[model samples]
Target chain A: MREKSGSRVSLRAMALLLCALIGASPVVAQELTTSLVDIHQGSPLSDRARGLGNGGYELQSGNRVSFNQWYRASWVDMHVDLLTQITEDAGILWGFGTGEQGEKYRIEPSLKLGFLTQMHPSPNSTLSLSLTTTIGGKLTEKSCQADYGDLGTYSVNCRLAASQMAPEETLKYLVNAKPESQHLWLNYRVTF
Target chain B: MPARHLKFGIATAFAMLSAPIASAQEAPDADEMAALCHGGLSICVSATIPAARTQAATTPGWMSPDVGAAWAAGYKGKGATITIVDDFSSTSRFSGNFGIGVQTQRHGEWTREEASMIAPLATIRSKDFTTSSSVTLAPGLNVLNLSYGMYATAGYSPNQIGWSAEEASIISYATRGSAIVSKAAGNDSVAVGGVTNGQQDYLDLALVGKASAIFVGALSTNGTTTNKAQLAWYSNYAGSNPLVQSHFLVVGVDGSKTDLYGTSFAAPIISGYAAIIGSKFTKATPTQITNDLLNTARTDTLVNYNASVYGKGEASLSRALAPVAIR
Candidate 1:
């Protein structure tokens, strides 16, 4: 029975590793171009941004890599992009007492899937329009930690261990960090 | 001479019978006295009167003083309504008047007073569960404070607990996440739903998995932002169940400060906290507000913190209100 249980665990681990390798593999591209962009550009590679909504400002930043594929057929042209973003430092500014007492920061990884299409009336024409749609949200299976601190030091989820203590006993700060809101983005670009 | 003696004896027998009848009329029997008392008589001679239940008067100081910061930030539970459901009167009378002379203080009165003192600007409504079990939800953000519990003579399963109209209504609201429900973990010093002296609080069992339900326990003393607090000697702890632990919270009861103590007083503080959170996160849903409080609870502020004992730990209004935007 013990040997059987060990074999089952080994099989599960191997299966998970295989899935990770497949997901990490780069997309097969006939032609590929990759470049880093500003975090605020709203592209898949732009993994960080700040915005004001619902009465407060929120800063969301993450590390991400994107894979893209372009296909051209006789009738139409298509582009597919897959991006994975990992939140390393996402913070929100909230006033508690004097100074920066209530600011909160967290980390959680997410994946974004996007599709783009472009049409050209004639090969010689310089005018073209491309439309893109992207869907993204936080991954459900991620580990998090709760930190009760004044300085907002750690970047992890607020699901703390049962008996963990804060760095400073005097200031026992609690943070209400929620999962990133799921979103769908559409963009249209016209080139001349 | 014999005829005169017979007439005297007959007169004596008549007098004795009439005298006994008159005495019976003057002093009613035990059954007759009980009947009179049931018929609304003011006084029933030789009847046992149950002792008058008493609670300590409300103290002037607020139990959780750190709420001052939230008040300073202009989140004094404005635009929210806190509905207190408890035994406001022994006669099952519903009175909107919170004035001193209108009615004598009962268990419900202390809870109402504490919640009002915590969030003075918030609207407070009383729901006398004795009169009717059904409760109507208020228009805007609503926080319902249940300082009383429904118990049975013998232990019953949650299904067999036989929820009344009010329990059903409150449970419906909690399950649907329509309002924030703060319940007092009973003062029996047992885990929630544990039987105490042959009686069990079935209401706690019924509310175990509801979405917005929170079971509040009492701490021994007033809690400060800098110091850790301990659970009161008589307050119930979160038992070994993870579901119960997830929804439980502890706050300072401080009978010394409030002149009132028990899990009953502990619940209103959480209700006030919910209303205050509503004032800040004006657009947040009831579930969102509930989560904000639970997720932000501080384990560091609790001495010997154990999930099974303290649940989510101490409810910190400052931490809950610290978030500027809550989805």
Candidate 2:
């Protein structure tokens, strides 16, 4: 776990949520000229490697103990966006997103720059076309913690008395516990 | 005969039944499989880390209830001490190519490793018994692990000779002192009661007399399914007497990082558990700790779930350390 970096992300996300809730009043909303909505979504493009392995033994108290195990996880994600104007004939469309990958969800930060073209076939109907591409986003590799102190339950097997469950069973328990990708919506609609 | 004389008598008779003691078979050590990270753990030893968190992270069940989850929760057996009494040597003592099993440095080191891996902070001492007449408990030792046991020769039961005088002395000392003795149920399949299928083990009546002593049996998991593990085919489990049933316990001895196996490995697991439990309930007596472990064990982990084979069930660190509630 990236203690410093992860905490920073958590703080920023909390701050963003706090700001969203504060300015949500209708009176404050009407004063703003821009009516904008941003949406993002993603999942893995391929299967993730289980990435579990064990080294042999080390001396502890002058005795040999099992070497710890290792684990890694990677996933593909997808997100999208839609835009429209309230009072202007010319409209602007934009999309920006990120992917969650590697051990700590190394944020695949990407900024999308796009232009929208509007075609008015008649007074009653209008069609719009937009194209956007993201930049500076890539997946990072995640492996099990190399250090025992950092591994938590990852380093030990779960036991009921002397009889214990398998090593991966405990690992799966830990992996299953971690939060999956968040803040990405596959489909979206705005209500007025 | 007096208690001391009788204790010596048991030792003499045990020696008479044996000469060069029958060697524990050189079965391929299964513990190496544990190094493969068998029990569903996601972590393994890397080519990194300081001297070692001692692989305490990966050996969750054998060392800690949840793979050092107890340590993270801050209940490592810091103040407790475990005394291992066996015909084991403290040092390797050999050059290369010595394929030693239980008879030499390999066994003792493996047992010590298992206990230390679980309770790294606890003190572990090997009081060798190769030439000694009787085992002694160190002043502060809270747990004594006896991973060796007498053989059942000529198809005879354990009662033919009360018990080994050396072991009996240790058990007697444990009974009167603050220490608890962890004994290995022998390898013979001798049944505790009338079960014909038995391994030559500690199915003797002498073991029942010591309230402070516990007989440990080896266990093995059958598959990935939860609670699929069962008593190792060779582990002894005779429950003809009440104390045997009350004092008996089973722990897993699957392949460990170092290729060790048998009840030899099992005894130390309980020893480690005892130390860990003792660390949490510093005020609890050795009897209290022993009883709590027996009382709180998880029988569900047994495949057949029979008290005759599993004793009171597998020892559970979490249950023993959990707070005792009042109405």
Candidate 3:
């Protein structure tokens, strides 16, 4: 029995090692274009991205990278675009006495389907419109904090009660929450 | 009775039982095992001991329902080591009879057994504090099970409780976040720092504010999803110090099941739980594992849960094990 149990443990350890190796491997993809952009309203990356009333006015800046593939459909031209953006060191402020305030980083990856039409009225002018859908969720490490002054100072690190730490809001969501945003985005662009 | 007297008694009994055997055989028959526990030896024998031995013979070890889910989920403390710091006779005596079904009547022996039962795959090491106060921590994830207390005469202040090498090593480890230290909140029926019966356990005072130290209290029975549990009548409480309360946790002792009672039995459960949590979160620091257990403890499972009384309430192994990231 001891031998069997030892063998089972060895097998599990090997499996865990394989999983770690796979998870640690870097993701590789072709890069097309990179640009810095700031969202003034309704950014799909932030948790507070509902609207102006819900603090959507908070400016979010990130480096946006676009990957594109072009194809000709019967009459008009078409292109599939992949937009990837990363918001680095974004501040996550907590309400009074709610938790320890901190910062988080997020990455938003989206796909866009669009059509292109040439205009004869203007030389070398083109019009394009695309439906962009963004997909993202909690992508940062979880943390716990408490105000040692407001809550009585405790000997333990992170003195607040577990409920006060809001683990369900911070840690649980990392495991069980769905994509943060999945709304249709309409964009029109004029290029020369 | 002095510890030396008990040690001599146990050694003599074992010698008598082993005299007829030429080679190592199956653990002494049940009748012989029972005889070893006769007279003052009842401390080693309980109604559950024989049954537990029978069960251990067939299975790896006994696990309480509270930690059963973690075991089923392949987190049976495979990568962790639990160093039990208690009195398990002398070094030579313990080394001679430290294996499955080899029961002894020492405080540390039962504590070791309890911890192994909870995390069957966890590496368990004995540091007989009676012989030496120095504890050498094992590599990898470590949980220090201190089911025994270092006490002083009544009215001794925290500063006056001369710290031993063992205490210093444990405090240093806990302060440095090197290991999770699970200490038994003495069975004095008073607050954690309260004095009882002419002595005070200063180990509790020294551990306060340490990064990964936890004071474990006992509940009368196990709490389940449907039923809530209550603090054992003799268990020490968290008291008014929020710092102490923040690091305190309570687990069921279930004397009827283990045939042993007191905060001593409660500490091993938490130690085992820490090891199980470490098994899952292999990358988690000792402090992270400590916070994971404290942050995920269940208040609703304890009747009229009060932080001052129950500390962090009943430790929920399932809740602690639920999180993918233990920060």
Candidate 4:
């Protein structure tokens, strides 16, 4: 009789534990795996090809920027720019982080805003840099045919200084040198 | 006190009545497909893929010259029908190969010519479904050869959102006695660790739809002469980060044979072998057949070796057919 009572008590304890575990799981979900904001900065162009003469092209591209010439090659900025992170408490956070950026191209003409990340991040808020390689945007217009001889092997020419789009919008903006244009930049983002 | 005992009895009866009801709600019955060959038997071949593609052979089907020889050796996959499932060209209709009439127009034809090469006297039924579609799999189909991978339209992320829906139906056919063989893809993605597709790890967290799938990966074409069986450069590997390591098998894909690229090519070889094996063991379930085949695979000399990559090693067709003779 004593053993039977003991077994019954143990069964009740097991059931209670199971119930408690199921109930407590919701709380676990609330625990932050990573921080909300780590850092955001303009990264280098991954596949941007610098005119390495002799028919050979040097690929260089940007990370933290949006551009129209996704199907075309991107160029490197001649000036020095510092990109940094905005952190709360310094610790490692992982998972996906989203942020926005605004860019005014000195020569290129375009407006852009979007999120960027390489892959899923650890469930924590960390800051790091990552680089991404991608193909340029496609050219569909006959005017593009006249400007760029071939649809392939073209580059994003940032030398075109822009004030505003013409009233007719004849010139389809290709690459935007602004950070907002970067849809998803591959980078080695450091979280600290 | 008497009322409490009455309550307990009622509870026990209620529990018994609810058990089957819950099961019925949880898992419904599976579909039934008509058998294709005689008494619904088949030959299940699991060969390294140099046998099928025309480019690989001097006269086509050269890698497994032994297979045709086996047929000539009086080991006809006779009285058996084989169903091959692959992303073949729209016109190469399987009928040109399997020697059977179009059982259903929904899929392509399996020509008797190919059937003559494997089993001279068997009826063949071929079914082809676009990789994206969730088609119902049937039993008694003798042998079902899936010579393709979980192909997603290019540019799409490898997410399991659409695949989960069809898991139950696929699992049902596998549970029943259906000779089904799927190529373990040719891409050499190591399945030992979590296979990162593009950039995400594929996890089989939900066991809702998984059978002992006969997944066959690829090896170099040099035959058994090579010491190590490196996972073909494109075959995706299986491992446990989301879970544990449970990948597929790898057979030969060497020689002058060029059709040895994707698991898509390797699947049919196993399907052909399964047809041959099924001919011998007339009453084996698809699950049992997969087990016996895997159990009979050759051991490799690689380290940290587990079933994730070299599943039961390379498939030995003769041994699987003549299990009792050599063992």
Candidate 5:
């Protein structure tokens, strides 16, 4: 079975090579394109990575309380994150943020690539469209979730939910969402 | 739990064009073979983009649904349900324009349309999995499609947190007869992790685990003909992950025309195929389906393509579903 699979993979490699040999330009190497860099502030992972409930939920008095809008959870809050480019266009963009109580920090690192509609001679004044997709993981500090008034009165102890990576939960939070959890995004930016 | 299912079918017209020898083994009758081959040829050639285009049409290419229509596996996936998890705004104008297996844009939405066009008959669902989670894994959803990833920060290395709960949930899905497909983000991470790509810890960790997961990298879609295939300039390379050593796959996706670039889009193409396979063999475990797809991929479009970037080469739905001869 392993050998058959190996042969199958080899076959695919050969096909792609043939496509390149027959269809690609050989006179000269393809010109290098500029890599893209940007800053994004969003949660890439859902509650899967939170630790087993133990810590207290940090609530700020009179502060805006945000619901996931999709998951119907009262713990939704926004964080400010920064992603920087490491190479000419390609690089790593990551940020660290805490929950409302400022006791929890989530680690987010995104592998990002950017595409611009057009390149302008004026590096500073060019207006371009950027499309970037970042694939990485998120880790949360071991903190506890306290039942807040927003969640209504519940006797069940809500110690910090165990921190784990749940692909399904993460996806569900994004799909059934009203505003915050949507996954695909497109933004326009200026070089200045 | 890991029972390997073996299937063998004669090469379809599409397969024969690239592997003539394989076709000869199955179709001894030249006339029948010619008809099959002709049909495929027609589909492949006909799928080409017409010469006319507005300035809006950049990097034009299309897959001919007709070429392998007869010879290609007719499985549009009978029972499997695929869930694509992304962060598109729920109120975006892209929703009502949704259609399976055909390309049309109501607004900025493209993937949902593309997925439906690829497998119009499959039971498909889309959701947003991006939220504040202490745990990355959702409790009990099958075949979750998470095509997004984080960049890998100093506090959290790649191998340690990159797989976290999301990776665990994928395993959970596989154990229950469903699979997950993740797109390898397209940024070149040479600076962070040296040569291959970025987030060595994360990509490496995910690759080594024996879970029923797939990491699809990207390929350029701007060739004039089928031969001009090349890895996207920004596709990441796998550093050293034992699991990833043999479990990578690449598939073609035209992100240039839409905002859907990166392995983010590539993962769904694989998910669509998985949906078809799962629907067909309802009893098969996720591991079996995962192995079958890997075993059946057509690597022709990624010659010399980095194993880290292309992974087993471009995916082929027709070949993956090749039937086992009754005789």
Candidate 6:
């Protein structure tokens, strides 16, 4: 009878703890740009990426913003004394962030800047110079870790092992690598 | 504090600590960014992008060489019948807009065009599932393409729900009858997960559809080359189910139109390959065709490959159509 009483008390305590947990889970739905956000979890590759055991999630919480847009903006260029418009430029650009391509699949920031500057020297002839550059965005050092289910690799190793089949099952490794991607281009043109 | 109270408190703390582990990645609305852009933009200006007009391949004027090689072998699905099942093809929902037979519907057209690249002479049939009679499956069809799946209602658990009986039986009956049912793995950007054990995961449509089907997932590409095929982030998948692994596959997403995406477009490519094999074998069963593709799938196609994420591997028409020796 004394043991039974103790068991009953334990059950009640567990339930109370679970209730408290359930009550606090609403914070997950909350989003903050500068705050930490859980992108995905239980990723075996993510675990290896961060040197965690097996299961861990990826995050995208920082001051990074996704911006992609194109507009036709026209502004007349006028020097201190010049009256007529000499050059005009109109172009489109897109800036975005995504996971890196290698084994350490971390977040990568990217931006594209472009402009077309045209000089109207005469009514029948004109010269144009087009400049474009792609800027790689900053990387976030923050990541999330969890208890990996070892349920499956989820192909995080497909590319890692694409060259050959793996021999070890217990060795903890990540399919995603902290992405180190760099892509930049600049174009200069003059057309008549 | 008493010993019992301390013990309970420690246990409570552990449980509380583990609670967040059960959390999953949150998915915003279809146009969540769009909504955000619209809001708080009353003072700022935004630009709009028009739909793509050229719809050209971003690759070097060629999508993949395997399909062409299969066609070169003279298979070309000459007499085989390839059936595509989707709502966009139904007459009731056609709406003279983007749908099957509506030349304007780029999504539907892309699937047809990709299939044609392999079996130009095959008899292509489009069955729109709008009513009872339309959903019927005719026997002797070499391959049936299903590029859709069920989505869970918001706030509901997918692990608890199962596929509808009507759909389940139809796929199963077809599979048993020797028709390779190529099904879509489904898109991400939604709450549903692919078929697998555990929370947030879903069963492969083959199991829920109660049919031995090839569940296809989407593979994103750089379009500049077919040398590497990466799994799409928004693709639904499964890795632990031994029963379904042999039949699940993923292919490059940028197959058809430049911007066309989703596993929906992934199914037709495999179906087309099956048709190419059928054009030659003329007597091969769906199981045989399925085996040919699975046995021939390659790991080298993936940059850093793992079976759990990629499944058997990408479809290989040349290997699938290769001659088998009498060993």
Best by lDDT: 3
- Worst lDDT run of 10 residues, candidate 5 chain B, spans B19-28
Fnat: each model in turn: 0.00, 0.00, 0.01, 0.00, 0.00, 0.00
- The lDDT-based order of candidates, best leading, equals 3, 1, 2, 6, 5, 4
lDDT of 5 by residue, B31-121 (tens): 1222211222121111111111111111123332211221132334445556655444433322221212334232113444445554555
In terms of DockQ, the best-performing candidate is 2
Per-residue CA lDDT of model 4 for A71-90, tens digit only, reads 23333322121111112221
Question: On residues B210-326, what C-alpha lDDT tens digit does candidate 1 reach at each position?
Answer: 899999988876554366788888788899988899999888876553345578778888898888767755667788888777876778777888998899988866455432221
User: Per-prediction RMSD in angstroms?
Assistant: 27.9, 15.7, 23.6, 33.0, 33.8, 31.2
Model 5, span A70-183: residue lDDT tens: 122234334433322222332222223332212233334334332223234466554433343434333333222322221122221112110011111111111111112112
Query: A29-97, model 1: which lDDT tens digit per residue?
Result: 222222121122121111211110011111111111111101111221112232211111111111111
Report the lDDT tens digits of candidate 2 across residue range B74-156: 44577788876643533332211112233324345556666776677789887655544566555443888766654433355
lDDT of 6 by residue, B1-327 (tens): 122222222222211111000001111111122331222211111211111111212212224454444333334677667776554432221112111232334233445555665467777776543322324444454677765544333333433554444344445555584677776666652222442222222333334333347777767752112466677766665465655666777776652334445676677778777776666455556676676666666666675777777777776654454322100
Model 5's C-alpha root-mean-square deviation from the true structure amounts to 33.8
Highest-scoring model, TM-score: 3
Instruction: Report the lDDT tens digits of candidate 3 across residue range B242-292.
Output: 988999998877655444567877888899888976775566789988987
Task: Return the TM-score for candidate 1, rounded to 2 decimals.
Answer: 0.50
Model 6 DockQ reads 0.01
Instruction: Give me the iRMSD of candidate 5, please.
Output: 25.6
> Against the hidden true structure, what lDDT does model 5 obtain?
0.37
Candidate 4 residue-wise lDDT, B1-327, digit = tens = 122222223222211111000000000111122211112122111111111111111123323433543343233454456655433334321111121222321112222233334444444555443332344544443555544333222233333334433333343455453545443343436552223344221212222124545665655431332354555555544443322222255555442333224444445456555665555444555665565555545554333355555655666554343212100
lDDT of 3 at A7: 39
Please estimate how well model 1 matches the true structure, expressed as its whole-model Cα lDDT: 0.52
Docking class of 5: incorrect
lDDT of 6 by residue, A1-192 (tens): 011222334433433343354332222211111111123222222222233112211111111111111111122111111011111232222223332322223433444333333445666556654333444432222211211111112222211111111112111222212222332333444455
